[model samples]
Target: MVEESAPDRTTVATVTRNTASTITAKFQADNSEPVENKNTWGYVNVTEVTDALQDTAAHDVCAPFNAPVPNYRAPHRRTIQVKCYEYIWLIKYREQTILKNEACKRHRLNLPKDVNPPSGERYTYQGEFPHMGIIGWKDKEGDYIFMCAGSLISAKFVITAAHCTNLRDPSVEKPTPDIVRFGDRSIVPEAADAEFTVESKIHRIIIHPVPNYRELYRFRLTE
Candidate 1:
């Protein structure tokens, strides 16, 4: 049987700080600062990257599959390829995971189980919980509605129930909240209100894996 060659593909690697300026200059001249184009997928020459890193410790870490370690593989001989967006996604995932873990460790709150006793209801909360907030949205008729509550988990992220997000009902459909109001108690603001409310536009919404809410609703209604 005759020996066959591997399929040729270009795999991109992270740009080094030394050549970043040069690359940026080139892109600036071309008038394209890494703009995503659905028509054409971008690629990088992995062989060039491997050859450059051959003498460095990085070559051993990211060497392509079926390639020998501590050696430079010629550009024509390497055939591994990866999409540019996929590589970006992996980097973002790693960075976000790190941030999430750090946030978890910093805000691991532990309180007594009997924090709230069976006392009579109280009307006022004197800024006891600064992180608590009210999530609000505007309906199609330009009406402000307070649907659910959320907690400020981080400076950029708000932890809230999944039901607060986009929802659909047999009779009515509702979009996700457009803004989050913090430190606001009254859903309807009054002229006599003294509390300060901070409103911020939501960038993203992450829903947690939960049991079927419909089943729970049915069970509750029957009970």
Candidate 2:
């Protein structure tokens, strides 16, 4: 206690840094006889006041995933991994190095670089023998029966054998050749390029006028 009187009291306190302290003072009153009053006290100094935090948070943090590098190759369909637990289909395109008969050279993989392509008589590709036409006949069931093959000489006419146009079958009218389909590779089962084929009606058949050619198979043009 610095200054204490009968009715009042005063006290001063000092605190050091990085330490804790407290202040207290005594009070008294001049009564009829010896008397005492309320005492005053207060907390002093301080430890520290701040949020509970860390300068650098420490935990298990995974980095982001990166796309895998691609290994370039020829045209094909393959699977690709885009993300974790995710996959996708990828189609790569390249030059046309395969014939229609051989969809790919996978059979000859790892072969010599200077080796020739798979050797076989391949003919049924696009734009191959485009002038060839199919000579068919409509039967009683409205189905076209492929009879013979012809060649298209012009846009409106096809050249075929006269015997193909004859109703040789013993039925009422044994399916005479009356239809010609051009720009086709298959006739019965319909090839993959069937949608691009052109079909036309036979307006008339003209057989060349030759002596003794009535029963003989000869070339004829149908308009």
Candidate 3:
């Protein structure tokens, strides 16, 4: 605690010491005649600091952690990199004829079922072959003429061989192919086709102009 009071020619309140007291102490420090000890009384204190080498804040601190750790695995190191490529040995493989995934296996096993039949053979149900289709047109005499077999892929389309139309009906002799028949397992002539039988109208038939495969001959067959 500091005392703030009127000085009796001495005391006062201040954070710094009095300059008069410092001057009085200096006067008493060397009371001998000024010229008598001139060689021992005064000398300049020399201090040289380069690049903060003499930083007084860390005077006695041993091994200060001021800088980041050095990275020995830095990219600038040249010999740390190595490159070599060796001959690879590949394992033998077996060719697969039919690849059946879980989805395909499930679809094959879980076909739609018909509990009761309206007509024809219910035991040998056509639901087992629901996607099968027969594409044909009626003749001019009203007699039905079957052309090519196809797969009823959707409610509106059937996929069939292009040769069925390309080579056979060259000049558009038949009527416009408007219907594709599916599930045509009619055991009796008078009975309805099948419980799953359906006929969908064809808007148009799109066939790829490119053949899937071509024969190559070098005096020997190779595939």
Candidate 4:
């Protein structure tokens, strides 16, 4: 096999400083500067200029701040680009601290659990499923229909799907049926053995701004 020769290096014009004035100056004017300074600045060697050029070229080709000590290779090179608008919100809200230490201390001290006993009944279960219970309802024809599924998130608020009680269409005559079921494995009304009257005073309905309508119906009917 023939021996391969190393790639020939090409000499590229390199600049030690990149000031706009130096870049825009004519080549003749730039070369004349050192010559004019020779008498005033003492004996000027052309080799010194060549050495400076080589030094600048070497610096440009070498890795910055010295190579890694362990000789590991980087998977990729990092490029940094910044946008002013991206940090505008963060800068504007920098001083706003909603959860101050004093407020946090007060909130921890006055936590709801320590204030009162859970208003609704509680149950324990064995298995991987959630321990919370839900209430179911029946239709006029006595067919089992799921009204809502609520968890005792707090003493006053029962967390359930908002679609259960809301109107699908305002023009429709009837709103979605309201039935609450507790301790039931399936949507069958007969399956529910215990029941509780919804305290209208404490009962509330809240619709999420981005509610998944398709999943909402399924959650209300099931868990």
Candidate 5:
């Protein structure tokens, strides 16, 4: 009798621990076999599976289903270093040709051939200015409202007018922005052109402490 090659021990252990219930369920469902232990969790529990999947996903930075690079991962601390890391990572992974070029193009990393963009709304499309973003707040009626326009110069920071963060009328307090949407062009929610818009919540707001025109004028004259 010919003997079959034994499978790797680690692979076997991983498969047994990970997919035993899944395989058992499918097999039992098809073959009409009763679970040996009914009350001992025959099926995979949702929470257990979710937690396990999350743990595994956290380790794989390049996994397709994992969340995109967070704003905190902005390579601004050392621009040259980040650029080099990105370049090496792409080349080592054999993604240097198309994927590398696409990324560089999107971030305006490399020198681009001068092509005059058409003036106005006629020439623009969704995701053209990925840096451009919007700040949104929720009204008392539970409606998500657009508060102001901003630009995403880095991963974590958005640059917007100071007036948007402050109000002169004591009755009008600036509500914390509940939502921040990136790569969206249209003001109307229904008219959003971006299919994969990046979104985040405003955790903190930093406004400059510049004085009003009257105060500035007086201070300038006095100084």
Candidate 6:
């Protein structure tokens, strides 16, 4: 009890320096009394503590696992091609200036300059021509009068008016005309080509059910 153990010589300088500074030594008291200056017992680096606290705050703020990442391509726009034939037709029709002027004036359509109108002169018939013929019955004087217009329907069968056959009384005993003209513009009865002569008698007649008499008259009048 009289002699105290020697203090660590190595820690003596450190203890002396700590005592000389504002820092103090601390030790636990007997009988569990409160220790004096217990907070200063161990060496603490303030810089290291501050650095660890800053790193923990940065990791909490970033929150790396909480949110999903965005797709770079999701917001992009696209274009599509389309074909438009009816729109092209409308554009072409709208651009004709002459047609536009006519519409504005409320006038009937003016024919284009290149088309030639039919001449007023009647086509007189001469004897014995080809392809051209008058479509009518023969009079008592053996002359063909005009009935309705006709074109050659076939070689053997001359297509003419149903009225042409029906107009005359059935009591008249004469056969229908066997002659057909070829290549002649005048309305004349003449011998046809060999094929026409061979096939001429087998004619088929077709009449429209609703004969538009006004249109037929207009066509004949114009001709």
Best by lDDT: 5
- In the range 29-77, model 6's lDDT, one tens digit per residue, is 2223432233442332233333423433334321221222112121111
Question: What's the TM-score of each model vs. the native?
Answer: 0.36, 0.41, 0.33, 0.26, 0.37, 0.23
Q: Kindly report which residue stretches of model 1 are placed more than 4 angstroms away from their true locations once superposed.
A: 1-120, 169-173, 191-195, 209-223
Report the lDDT tens digits of candidate 4 across residue range 109-201: 454434432388322221213334453333456554554566655444446555655645443334654444444433433323233222222
For candidate 1, the lDDT comes to 0.48
Model 3: CA > 4 A from native: 1-124, 167-176, 186-196, 211-223
* Model 2, runs deviating above 4 Å: 1-122, 170-175, 190-192, 211-223
lDDT of 2 by residue, 1-223 (tens): 6985553223222223112221112112322332211121122111111111111111111111122323422122123212211211111111111221233222224334465544884435445688888877777776776768777777676776666667576532354676787776555443324656777777776666662333333233444
For all predictions, the C-alpha RMSD in Å is 21.4, 30.5, 34.9, 24.3, 19.8, 39.4
Cα lDDT tens digits, model 5, 1-223, are: 9999999999899988679789767767876545443344323233432333444344423223322222212322245434544444434333322333333233342335554334662323344677777777666567666767777656667766655554343332244555578766555665454465777776666644765422211000000
- Which run of 10 residues does model 3 get worst, by summed lDDT? 84-93
Q: Candidate 2 — worst ten consecutive residues by lDDT sum?
A: 48-57
Once model 6 is optimally superposed onto the true structure by TM-score, how far is the C-alpha of residue 70 displaced, in angstroms? 89
Clashing pairs in 1: none
List runs of model 6 lying over 4 Å from the truth.
Answer: 1-132, 153-180, 188-204, 211-223
Query: Which of the predicted structures, 3 or 5, would earn the higher lDDT when compared with the native?
Result: 5
Candidate with more favorable, higher lDDT: 5 or 6: 5
lDDT of the candidates, in the order given? 0.48, 0.45, 0.40, 0.36, 0.50, 0.35
Worst 10 residues of 5 by lDDT: 214-223
What is the alpha-carbon lDDT for the whole of candidate 4?
0.36
lDDT of 1 at 24: 56
Ten-residue region with minimum lDDT total, candidate 6: 74-83
- Candidates, ranked, TM-score: 2, 5, 1, 3, 4, 6
Look at candidate 3 and tell me the lDDT of residue 204: 57
